[model samples]
Target: MAAARDRGVRLGRPPAALPEGAPRAAELRAAGNSLAQIAAALNAEQVATPSGRGQWTKSSVQYVLTRYDQERADDG
Candidate 1:
């Protein structure tokens, strides 16, 4: 485990599942949807959240989207 950590292995509860409409959410955001609006759109599409309960909220949507965007940025 220590050796894996030295190699940058992340040890935690596995990454949460991205909501089904994540790509669409990114598209909507690029087209200028507010975080709240993205959440609403996702909810309207019946996209399941990582937690699998409750309606989508701006914060949750932001977390997922921001993490995804950051990862993408890092890859480039």
Candidate 2:
């Protein structure tokens, strides 16, 4: 473990990444759109969800936004 750490190898599940529409969702949210509205807009734009199989839901939007915020906070 020490050797791996010295080699800069991260040894756990990788951090969650923002999905394709995450930035747009953040933008819509910053513009005061509700989570439902953001999800609908993402659907209207045919943006793929993180899973790339299902439609965007309010919960998914919230998840993406929370992940996005966490990433930003970590970066700063």
Candidate 3:
């Protein structure tokens, strides 16, 4: 069990929200930061995942962007 834990097995929080800060992320995009760039920044900041991962899985980033678009559409 100890060995398994040492093997990068996470046994804590589910993981952090997938590259959150939707508004912040969108702002970065509008300011010319690419999606990859935003992800990198979030990772660099050590954003936690619900599963306790330290990075995003791409799809997560896309999810945030999609949500933001939907929100804007609804607001207008």
Model number with the top lDDT: 2
Itemize residue pairs with steric clashes in candidate 1. none
Model 1: CA > 4 A from native: 1-14
User: What stretches of model 2 exceed 4 Å from their correct place?
Assistant: 1-12
lDDT (Cα, tens digit) per residue for candidate 1, span 1-76: 9999999999889766566667787998999999999899889988887588888899988888987787678889
lDDT of 3 by residue, 1-76 (tens): 6887999887777633434467766776788877788777767766653346657546655677777777789789
Given candidate 1, what's the lDDT at residue 10?
93
Candidate 3: the clashing residue pairs are: 14-50, 14-51, 15-49, 15-50, 15-51, 15-52, 16-48, 16-49, 16-50
What TM-score number comes out for model 3?
0.57
Higher-lDDT candidate of 2 and 3: 2
Largest TM-score belongs to which candidate?
2
Q: Which of the two candidates, 1 or 2, achieves a greater lDDT against the reference?
A: 2
Look at candidate 3 and tell me the lDDT of residue 62.
66
TM-score of every model versus the real structure: 0.72, 0.80, 0.57
TM-score of model number 1:
0.72
Query: For candidate 3, what is the lDDT?
Result: 0.67
Ranking by TM-score: 2, 1, 3
